[model samples]
Target chain A: MKRRIGAAGLSLFISATLVITGCAQQKILDKMGLSVVIGYDRVDKDRLLGTNVLHQFDPMASESVQIVASTAYTSKGTRDKSNLEMAKKAVSGQLRVTLYSEQLAKEGIINLVDTLARDPTIGARVFLAISKGRAHDILKHRYPEFGNIGTYMYQTISQNIEGESMISPTLHDFMHDYSSVGRDTILPYLEQRGKEGNELVISGAALFQQDRMVGVIPTKEVFYVKLLRDRFQAGSIEISIPREVLGKYMKVSQKKRGNDPIFLVLDTLSSSSTFKLVDKNRPQINTEIKITGRLQEVSEVVDLSKPEIIHKIEKAISQAMMNEGNKVIAKLQKLETDPIGFGEIYRSSVRHSNLTRDKWYEMYRDAKLNLKVEMTLVRTGVIE
Target chain B: MKSIGKPGEHQVFSTFFLFWVIIESQIGMGILQFQRKVVQVAHHDAWISVLITGGVIHVVVWFMIRTLAKYESADLYEIHQHALGKWIGNLLSILYMAYLLLLGTLVLRSYIEVVQTWLFPEIPTWLLSSSVLLLTVYGVLGGIRIIVGVCILSYLFSIALLFFLAYNLPYADWRSLSPVMEANFQELIIGAKQMAFTVVGFEIIYFVYPYLKEKKKAGRYTQMGVLYTTLIYCLVLVLSIAFFSEGQIKKTVWPSLSLFKIVQIPFLERFEYVTVSLWLLVIVPNLLLYLWAATRGMKKVFHWNQRRSVYLSAALVLAICLLLKTNLQIKFLGEWAGQLSLYLVFVYPVILYFIVLIRTRKQRKEVK
Candidate 1:
């Protein structure tokens, strides 16, 4: 009887404790406001403009996203002020993309990026991009196809990166590169293309010296930059062969008539790049890039069936890639940015030396780059 | 002296169960921040420091087991009373109990800090502390057998989290750990010293030794437990070094959790949130085992009821956790507890081993 009473009292205590603690206030799906994409733009020297597209799942309303803009001294301050106007609590847990205007990115993004990094709700995979124009305008604009601009922009940037068109950097990746001694990070540079400004396009990539954007490279050149920085899995490059070089491989009549351009688009199957610091004091980099791909398209028909002709095409492609790679390296060197992580390679190779970031930057500016490109054309498509 | 355990209850834990208890206790809140702390001292050579610390801990474990083996079925408390005499031994036993209590409090406070920083920010401290302490109390009330069961279950559930390290491999740059052995001897020693906090909890074996079913094989099993912990710590330390840059590792508060940031799954958006929640399983056993050891110590030394000691210690731990409100205060608490543990677990064990050696030799001479 005593044991039974003790058991009953223990159960009562357990239930009572559970009842008193209650449940955490449930955030109903309909009432909660989720911000998927946030944008930051420079307003002035002291103040800043913050914009976000709040994803609302309304059972009654037709629209699902609201673009709210506010001015504040800091990112959190802006969120708190924006919260006063919203119908529900604005949460950033589902934040998929964050945009920074080029102006703000140039002034420095470390502080804002730190805010995002410090937030536990925001994942490291959230896309971070730099807008060519005002980031606020990008968030405010609407497209007919995408009902929700936030998810649409996120998918757009994510897919382009997966498609190997632009380099996709998350907030964590940016912070990693920004904090690392020998490396600088690049972000997808987005611009409003066409006269209507209705279309948001990922145009090129913005390079950072540290936390600040130093320069932007054109979209075409970004391909070479990626080749120098990362291994390639599935990206295509179009090389325009000189008419004279094409004539050497085929009949003049087959090369097409006057003023017609001949192009070869190679779809990369696999590629790898190796960076070696051959000279420590002078800091000379030997970059070897091996690319294996199949010829996808040719504007003018050239006989790729013969081994000699294939060899000549390979030579031409390697020469073209080497020149392009050199140009990209020169541009990065002129900007004094080591986005290729040449400094990291140098640091790894040398030992027992005190190499500061400043010293590495100086070396990067004066460093000489030697590029070697190896191209293997495996197949010329199904049509020969 | 009265036997602390019933005849059948004394042998409830098998050799394998002993392994799990040592490992579960050794890897608590420390694993989350150990990489950052070690890296701050040794830089890229932190893995080497970890290995050195592992070797030293193996020697220390050997000494502790040897000392415990001198007594037939006596634990550290009984051994102290027998070897050091009544007053001095009782005083040292009290210090050990206080040390165990502080260790439990540090683990709870650190786990709460991680939860507050990572999961629920608005929840009050006393609420979280009470919940964890209640769970701990429940496990302790079940006694050592049930606590070992929880340890076995927690080991099974959380061991797979180590596999998540593979997800970070793609981002890992082997070059970050290159030019190894760069740290001087002093720096490496400091790094190993920093690891003492994370590695100290295995010393609970001195208290748990007498309860093992196969006391003869306890030495091998306990060493295996410490070996497993060393391997895990080394694996995590190396992975953190390879994943983060040297400068980044030093700045990160919780390198282990931060490394999980790179993990992306289709269904889960924030993997760290899931990891932090699952980490509760890993944390409960540490709190349960250490608090149980403390309560057991108090019961033996002061002739208090075991249940009363458990309640008193649990309340003390909860109060300490509540009082350590700020990050700086919690950090100081952790540092002091670590320093105290270094003396109690490392330095004191060696001294006690010598004392036990002399006492046994003198007793043999008198018998002759």
Candidate 2:
């Protein structure tokens, strides 16, 4: 009986000790003022000023609202130093959008990227965008419709690419392209518009040549660039064909419209890219862009299901692709950047130790593009 | 000695448990660090090496079961005594015990290191290692049946842990797996050699064979364990390759851990913290299994009580773990041990099986 009591007492003692330890080791959620968005710009020599946008959710409120502000000259003089200083309280774990000024990106971000990649706190999946205007000014602007403009603008830019005009570039996708040998990095460019109640507009895409921002493309070509890069989704493509070409092609098919230039809106487009290395030594690159698209709607359509109408649309797609492809290629060639990741193909396929940056530029300058348009107008919508 | 007795006659393990035991033991510490070693040799086709080594495992496990089945009541030490001379057999048994001890200690230390890096940075290494040791010793005290029960419980935790890898799918670049079979056949063979550490631990069955209620089912159970282990580790390996590029995998120290850290939970900021927390359940069972084997071997070879053998062996392993200072040093030691274990676990068993086979035939001829 005494031994049984002694054993029971010992179990109680151990249980009590365990309870105390468990309570002591309780993981306290350190409310370190989680920053949702951060923007960086070059300030002085070897110094950078950073702004972090923070959000605090009020539990009592019906809907979650956010707080936005700018904190500059955060202790660390350099970009990495500034990031680390901000990271202490910012909670980069929740950070979704990271915007960089054009000047800072143009200066070269390999060093800054290395720091971001090495840090455990900063997420690799966050969206990276290049601001067309001052990144600080864009961050400072607030939209009356969205309470927290930082998150609002970030999501607005990303979500718009589905149905509207934009290019979606997540941090993961950006990093993949940036690290690839043939491909360069691209980011959706946004800027503040108007003076009073400023609105952020998604411009085109900022193209980079090995971590250095080289040039930009407008929203018109941004669609074509994305299509060529195989980033197409459910978005409409607007094409304007001269009245003469429209008349020449559409005259064969049915009840023709009276007398306006045909404006074709193409949707549900899918593009496939195939590349071949012609010569391994002085390597000549051949790229084939095949597009599959359906006609969503037309401004002046006489017949929807006619073979001639499909032929006209196909020709229009071909012409549109050629014009847009040339504009993008010319710009890329001028900037000596391959944002399509063609350089990656070269690096992966042809094993050449002597192939330097200058050699790649020289080779890419001469690489040819073949555009093939295969449009299947499966349905002309309910209007037809 | 208290007996939990044979797992009740009706208590057959579920196929899932067989699958779980195999995969859980296989996937342990190797998931985090084996990539570099294999890639160093195999380059792009290291996965082929994995397949080849898996075949090698099938053969080794078969031989191990055949050798252990020779004696119904004994283990590796007894088999060695019967096959080889008593003195040499005892010496080999001691070496085997030491190997198991070193392995357990290294795994324990590395687990603590992971805990330090990912979770409680301020916690002392001794405290973490001691706590794990305390739990493992408690489990070990319950004997083999209870240890296997803890392993079964830990398997459920492993399934939950696997969900964390799904978050990495968004970042996975399929191009990283391109240029498949870039390495030649020789490099592929070398890659398989590095997988030796990943596929080991089923050798624990030699000691465990006696404790099993149904000895005939032991072979099937052991094979099931290994196959499951290979499947799990292979899935992890493929995930790492898919998530990170070859260049990136070569640079990262702990690719599996890095993969987990990338997972951002809606409610929890650091999900790897949750993974590291559950990781204790996995590593403790593994450590306890290895430690029990060492103690059991020591008792058999030296004619000592298991209590004395266990205390002395655990002390030695603890001392060795305390000696290692940094992660790099631990890595270096682990690599060297892996290389040695290839011989101890694989080559030695195959050679012994052949020798025993030839001897048994000769004895039968002489008796006729």
Candidate 3:
């Protein structure tokens, strides 16, 4: 009976110790500066201007987020400096977006990217973008609609990618492409727009030659880049068909406004791509893209009930896609960036060989690319 | 002496539980980083190396079980005493106890390192280590029955974590594993050697063999356990290779945790935090079983009370873990433990098998 009592007392003492130790380590939500969005800009060749949008959950506070800025030699160094000025300790475990100014990205982002990749606390899904102006300026803009700038930027980028306006490249995806032998990474280019330049916009995609930004593709041409690089789905493209093609079938006046050719807008419902390396020495690639879409808009009245008319439209659309795809491929080749991963495909197809990065780059610079597009019109609009 | 297993006291484990014990032991901290280690050596052909390693382990396990079966209802400690005599056997048993204690320490320290890096950076090492050690003490005091129960429960709870790996399929590029057999035989062997540590947990069967209800069926069940572990290792390795490129896998320290970074549930933003927390369940069983084995060995060798020996072993593990504070020291400790286990589980088993075989032959000759 005495031993039982002593065991009970010991157990009580252990539980009491556990309870005391547990509370000392408790990270109360309010006490932590949950940094949701972080932006980096080049202060000089040796320093970085870092800005972070710290999130607060207190209902009584006037603003739920406060922007903090600091200058340091490294990313973590910047965080440490910024923490000294903040009320709460800055935590990056909830980081949603990492933005860099175009100037800084043009210098090199591999160092910052390495820091993110090395930290196991940071998730791989965080969006990484290159801002048109200073990244700190973008972070400073008040996004009243989002309540928090970090969440707002994250949601905007996520929704755009899901809606097929842009390709979503997370930090993990960028690291994969950067580390892989034959591929380079692309990130969404964000810019400030609106009457006062207060609104943030995903302008286009910034292409990288190795780790430095070489150029940007305009938003309108992003579709062609996507068509060449990724399997497409749920994106709409408008193609201008020559008025002469529909001269006999429809009234030519309706096909043209003044001297402009009529535009046929098609909404892609589904798409798939296949690439084959036909030759190794010359490095010729045969790329076939199969697309299925519904006709959303047609300027001229055509006999949609006729299968031949549909076939002609499909041929015209395929021809237009091929022309645009060739132009984009040529541009990417001239820029010496293989975001389309043709070199990766080639590497996978070949046997054991000494295909180094320089060898692939040289081949890609002169490789002949043959593009074939097969479009199937799955449905026409209700008016048709 | 208190009998660990009496005639009819529900002490003997069923064949089904035996299978889980082997699995829970083999699939702990090693699964988290073996992909990177193997890939560092074999490159794209790491999966094949894993298969070869599994086959080699099966042969070693076969030798171990055969040696243990020579003396009925006797563990490795008793077998050592019978074959090597009292003084030499006691020395070997003490070494085995130290080996087991080192195993437990390596596992605990590795797990705590992961937790600190991934989950709680602010929590001190002693706080976390002591909490885990306390739970381990509670579980160990419950004896083998409770340890086996924890193993079974750990298996059931953590088995679903593998299913979460399916999230990586969409991102997996099958071409990354292309040009199969790219690594030559020598490289593949090196890769297999790197895998020796992760697969060493199956050797626990030599200690647990005497506690089985149907000792005759233990070999088959144990093999099944090994086969399941191999399949799991293969699946994780293949997925890791397919998900990350060769260069990327080489750079990642914990490829398994990195793989979990891509798993995004609707309600959960950071899946790895959840995984690391629940992984304590997976880690506790490994710590408990190894410490239990070490304490049991010590009890047999020194004739110490089992409870007192358990306390001593746990304290030893905690002290060693605390002493290895730096990442470099922890890494060295892991490598040292792996090398030691490789010798004990692989090389020593084959040598002991021959000894047992020659002794049996000589005894029959003397009887005639």
Candidate 4:
């Protein structure tokens, strides 16, 4: 009889435990608000104009509509204030993309990044990009053509991975580059391109010294920068040489800039760059650039492919690379953004130099550079 | 010494559980904010300091094992009573108990602060602290064997948490770890000092020594545990450093969790939530072991019953944790406590070892 009483009591306790465990919240998909994109721009000393793209598929509208809202205040205040502005509860659990304006980025994004980083609500998977124009313009651009401006912007930049013109920078990567001494930073630059009857596009990239934007490189130059930075995976480049220079070659490729002339199109078939820090005491920087490319198409095809002609094509391409490489190097030196990773080279080769910020910038302008381009003409387009 | 039907038989842990206890207890809340503390000294070479500290702790564990083996049946409290006179021994033992209680509460307080600041803004701070502490007391009440067993199980789940973090590799830049050893040797040593706080749990052998079924192999177990814990700690530390550069690490409060937040799955998002949940599992062993030590010390010094003393001590700790005013205060207390306890955990053991050695040599010479 006593044993039966003990068993009955144990059953009641077990049932009660089950009830409590059942009541404890286990997160469900329906309970979460999936935020795919977040945009931040500095409004004033104490306020951050924050905007986010929350994805929603409205069955009534018969299409996907992303809810966009802007709240202006400090991070803590904005977070609280945005809660009331949101249609449904704003959940940053799925935030994948964080967009910063050129102004906010140049002003040093570390403070803004700190807010996102410190908050547990924001997902770490969020990719970071810098808007070339106003962040609000990018955030508010109603491409009624595309479902969501934020989604379109994020997808457009990410697709450049295959092209290798611009790197898809994550919030973590941006922070890393921002902190590294030997390197400045680059962000996939976005600007709302296109006018009426066309959809806005986010393309190209921006180069920065630490946190401040020093200059903007168009999509074409961004490719070369990526190559120098060793971030290039697969991208194409075209250099044009004069027709007279091409006459010595069977076939020569060219890219026309406003129809002014022709430079040989050394369609960047493949390229690799390496940095060497020789003579730490002398404070020298040497970069060896090797590019292998095929003459895909010739503006003027001279004759059947010949060995002499091919050699002429190779020489011309080499000279062109040196000129273009110098131009890029000059621009980088002027800006003092070591997107070429000279600081990293210094760290690796001259481990004991103890180079400080001012010293590195001084050395960078005077650094020696070596450029080498190797070209192989596989065939003359689709013909001999 | 009352007959309990073979206590050692009930105390032997499976190799799996032993591995779990080491990893979970070693990780603690330190894994979240550890890099910031170390970077203040070591800069980028903090990972190396971790390796050196691991080696140092291994040697400390060896000496501790030798001391324990010589004493045979005696644990830390018993050894203190034998080596020092009753009054002094009891006083020092009281110090150890106070340190353990404070350490456990600090862990609870810091975790509450993190949760309140990050996840649930609406929830009251005391409620979260109470809920976590209540669960901790449940494990503490289960005794040492059950605590170790739960640690093993929770460790398996926590190790699986690494899979999500490991997925962020495509985003990792190997160069970020470069400019290697740029921060000189002195900086690295400071980093080693910081790493010691994160790796503090192995000294629990002082309390659990008598519970080992194979008393002779207790040293081997401790070595294996420390090694496994070191590997995980270093792995996470390296991943954090490689993913974020020195500047980024300095600003990041919880690098490991941040790494998880960056990692996304095709089917689901918000990995940080899962990471926090898993961390809850990992910190439980740290809480249980500390509470167990506090209870065991009370039993020895005050002759208090185990059940009554554990409940009373846990209640007092909970109250103290609740009273800890602000997040900054809790952090300040935790850091100061860790630094103070370092003297007890690292310095005191070495001092005691030498004193015991001198006494033993003198006794032998007298006999001869």
Candidate 5:
């Protein structure tokens, strides 16, 4: 009993001693400035310009938010520089979005992105996008609707990513594609629009070869990229069909809009794509896409009561998808970007392929895309 | 005093405890980053090396159990005394005890390194090491049953710990697993050798043998533990290979933790941060098991009370943990420990089993 008491006392003493030592550093929320969104622009070969949008919660402060622009040679350097310029310590624990200028992304952003990837504080879910011009301009604009530029852009990208219209541009995906030999990084392309430039528009996706932006494709074509590259559920797409296929079943009131392609919107879409290397010698890829969805809208209304109409719609949609798929693949080939990962299929499907980035890029230009699409119109909304 | 420790009945535990003991011992801080070193040599086919090394573990463990089963309630120390005689046996036991202490030190120091880097970067090494050492000392004093209970908890923690890797599944590019047999036999052999430290710690079975109530079933259950560990290592290796690109895995210091860096959960902004903290449960059992074995060595070989040895060993490990100033030094210590474990845990056991067999045969003939 005496020994037990002694052991308990010793444990308590040790705990007390260590607790009092207080080795780890503590950062109180009030003392530190939390950066939510950071923007980067390349000024020269050796210098970088960065804009830090910090969140302000202090009631005593005059400004509603804090925006500090610092010029540095590295991303961490900018954070450190901005910290010196601020009233409080700058911390990236709440960093939600990172934006790169088109010029900076064109010059290659790996040297800039490496710091965030290496740091433990920055999360993998942080949104990454490319501004059409200078990222500083986009980050500097304080829109009336948004309180914080960082979270506003993050939510914008996050919502679209969840809805299936936007390609995922998270830091994790960027690093994955950046290092992957067979795939390239794709990021949301942002442009400040409207008369006063108060509105932020995610106009397209910026395609990257290695870390440099090689080309930009509008959101309309990005739908085809999504169809080929990713699996989607409850995703909606608006397709423009020629009047020739749908004119027969057209609603009488819609005849005034003659020769304009019929618009069809499909919602609650579940799509699966399969890529198989049928011929490995020349890197020919056979892609099979199966899509099932309910028709939510049609510009020229078609009779939904007939099985013949569904068959015609399927054939017409399949034809339209095949043509768009061909165009996207051709554009990707021209851009020398393998975002569809045909090169990955080559490397994975073959033994001792020993694929290097440059080598795969060369083969990717000539790689045949054998495309097939099977669309199943499951329901015609609540009507049918 | 007898060469073997004969603890009271309350200290002894059931045979199922051996299963958790083997697993809890083998999987520790090593699993956090072993893939980095392993993939360096074997490239994408590193999982094959992990598989081959796992096969060799069964043979090594069989040798250990066979040698220990030859005597009633005798452990590594007793077997050393019986086969090699007094002075030499005590010296060997002493070295093994020190190695066990060093094993504890390695676990403590590496865990501190992880915490310092990943979670609380400002925490001084002395405070954290002493804190962990104190906890280990407190746990070990409860004896083998208490250590086994901790090991059981560690089993659940290990599952949740590695389950963090599953979060990287959607982005997993499994094609990296293709061109699987590209690694030459030599590279595979080198890679398998590199996995030594990670798959080790099953050697504790030799030390814990006397504390088991059903020693007869120890071999079968012990083998089961190793089998499951192999399955887990393979599964993790496969997942890691599929999850990370070849170039990316090469750059990653801790492939397992880095796998969680990409996990996007609603409630947890940074999942790896939470992972680093919960890791305390996993490493605590390891510290307890090794500390217990080393203290038991003190009681058996030097006739010191376990209570005295527990504090002494924990302090020694804590001192090393604080004194190692840099991660480079800690890494160097780990390499040295890894090489030593190769000889002591893997090669030496089979040789000892032979000596035990020969010595016992000779003694029977002399008695006749």
Candidate 6:
């Protein structure tokens, strides 16, 4: 009889426990607003002009993504204020991309990016970029071609990263570079252009001295940065070589670029770059880059049957890449930024350099990037 | 003095189970964030600190086993009473039980903190902790074999999570591990000392020694368990140093969990959220092992039923978890436990071993 009473009480306690776990307010998918992309622009002294692009979950909603722009003293404050205007509750669980204007990035966007890194709901892989103009302008505008600008921006940056044309500027990378000594971060620079400034363009990448954007590497020269900074799984580049190099071994004709600098597009390109800190006192980096790819297209009609032509093209491509790489390094030094991670080489190679961000930047200013580019053209088109 | 903890034939388990028992207890909450503490001391050379610390723990565990092996089936509580007189021994045993209860409370607090901050934002502390602590109660209620089953299952399920670190490989700067031995011997030792906090739970061997079916081989299996836990810590600390910048890792509270942030699963939007929820299963063995050890001591010291003591321990740990509502309190709780275990778990066992050694030598002399 006593055992039966104990069993009845235990059953009641077990059933009661279930109700307590479900007490938190339910976030039904349809009713909750998922903030997909957020843009933060600096306002007055203590406030930030924040823009949130809400993903459309309702079928009947006319617009694809709802844009909410507001100013707040803190990042979360902006979220709460944006929530006041939205019908559904705004949540950051699906936030994919965060944009900061060049103006904001100049002052340093770590304060904003840290919150993203701190939020467990926000992914470390979220694309972090810099806008040419106000970040609000890039996020709030609607284009005639695309419905969801936020996702389009995410897809563009991600596909390019996958394509190996750009270095990753993820929240993880940003925090890693920010907290790590000796290395700085580079972020993809975005601008809205093409008639009424609604079309999105990836013009360049912003070179950051620590957290602040110090200079920009144009889209054309970004190849050189990627070449030095990261290894390519599979990347392609269009190199315009002087017609003289190829003219030696193969018949060349001028069709474009006036001087007939033949546009040689190398596809299925893979590369490995090694940085050696031979001269630690002055910081001279001897970079050895080996690139292997097949010829996908030649702007000018050229015969591909001969081995001499392939060797000549390879040599010409190597020389052009070397020159471009040096030029990029020169520009990077002038900007006082070490996006290629010369600081890392300097810190690692030297036993006790006591390298800090400020100290490395000084060394980086005098650092020279000595380049040796080896290019191999395995196959020239489908023919022999 | 009475011979203690000689279980019936049904209660004895194989030495193989000790491996899971050691790792499950050792891996609680610390794996999530130990790198931050060591990084502050050792800087880039934190991995070395972790490796050396792991080496020292092996020796400490050996001494613990030697002491426990002196008795036929007695655990730390019984050994304490035998080594010291009954009052002094039981007092020491009570302090050890308190230490076990504290570790269980800390594991509960930290797991609940992660759950609140990550997966479920509005979860009340009482609800989440009670839900988890109830599992500990249930596991303890079942028996030693049931708890071992949970630890083995916890071991199998949680080992797969380490593969997620592969996602951070592309962004990894292996060069960051450079200037590796730059830290002085003093700094390396300091780093290792800080790491002592994370590696605390392996001393469960003191209580778990008697349950082994083959006591002769328990040393090999127990050492292997500590070795596996050490390797796991070394792997995580090395990866974290490589994946994060020296300055960036210190800013992170839970470096290992942060490593899981970039896990790319096509179907799952955020993998860390899933990981934080799944961690509920991972931390269960920590509670089970600690609470199980505490209740046994409680049963012997108070002469109470082990079942009733299990309830008392779970409720006490739950109350502490409830009172530790803020982050500061949780941090204090961890620091207090880590500091206490540094002496009790690592240093005290060696002292106790010497005491037992002297007492037994004196007893043999008198008999001769």
Chain A TM-score values, per prediction: 0.95, 0.81, 0.93, 0.84, 0.94, 0.95
Candidate 2 collision pairs: A35-A90, A181-A344, A182-A343, A182-A344, A183-A341, B22-B225, B22-B229, B23-B229
- TM-scores for all predictions: 0.51, 0.48, 0.50, 0.49, 0.51, 0.51
Q: What DockQ results do all the predictions give, each relative to the true complex?
A: 0.01, 0.01, 0.01, 0.01, 0.01, 0.01
Residue B31 in model 4: shift from native, Å? 0.8
Give candidate 6 regions above 4 Å deviation: A1-384
Model 3: CA > 4 A from native:
A1-384, B1-8
- lDDT per residue, candidate 4, A236-273, as tens digits? 67776544555443222432323343544544345667
How badly does each model clash, as a count of residue pairs? 0, 8, 0, 14, 0, 0
* C-alpha lDDT of residue B173 in model 4: 83
Model 1 local distance difference test score: 0.85
Candidate 4 chain B, poorest ten consecutive residues by summed lDDT: B1-10
Question: Which whole-number lDDT from 0 to 100 does residue A241 have in model 6?
Answer: 87
Candidate 2, CAPRI quality class derived from DockQ: incorrect
Instruction: Report lDDT (CA) for all predictions.
Output: 0.85, 0.70, 0.85, 0.71, 0.85, 0.85
lDDT by residue (tens digit), candidate 5, B49-71: 99899999999999999998888
- In model 1, what are the clashing residue pairs, if there are any? none
Comparison by lDDT, 3 against 4, better one: 3
RMSD of each: 23.0, 22.8, 23.4, 24.5, 23.5, 23.1
**C-alpha lDDT of residue B339 in model 5:** 95
Error of 6 at B36 (Å): 0.3
Q: Which candidate do you rate higher for lDDT, 3 or 6?
A: 6
Alpha carbon lDDT at A357, candidate 3? 74
Q: Write the per-residue lDDT of candidate 1 for residues B287-360, one digit (tens) a residue.
A: 99888888998888888998998899999998888888555567767888888888888899999999989998
Interface RMSD of structure candidate 6 (Å): 27.1
How many residue-pair clashes does candidate 2 contain? 8
Candidate 4 segments exceeding 4 Å error: A1-384, B1-8, B12-17, B360-368
Each model's interface RMSD (Å)? 27.0, 27.9, 27.0, 29.8, 27.0, 27.1
Clashes of 4: 14
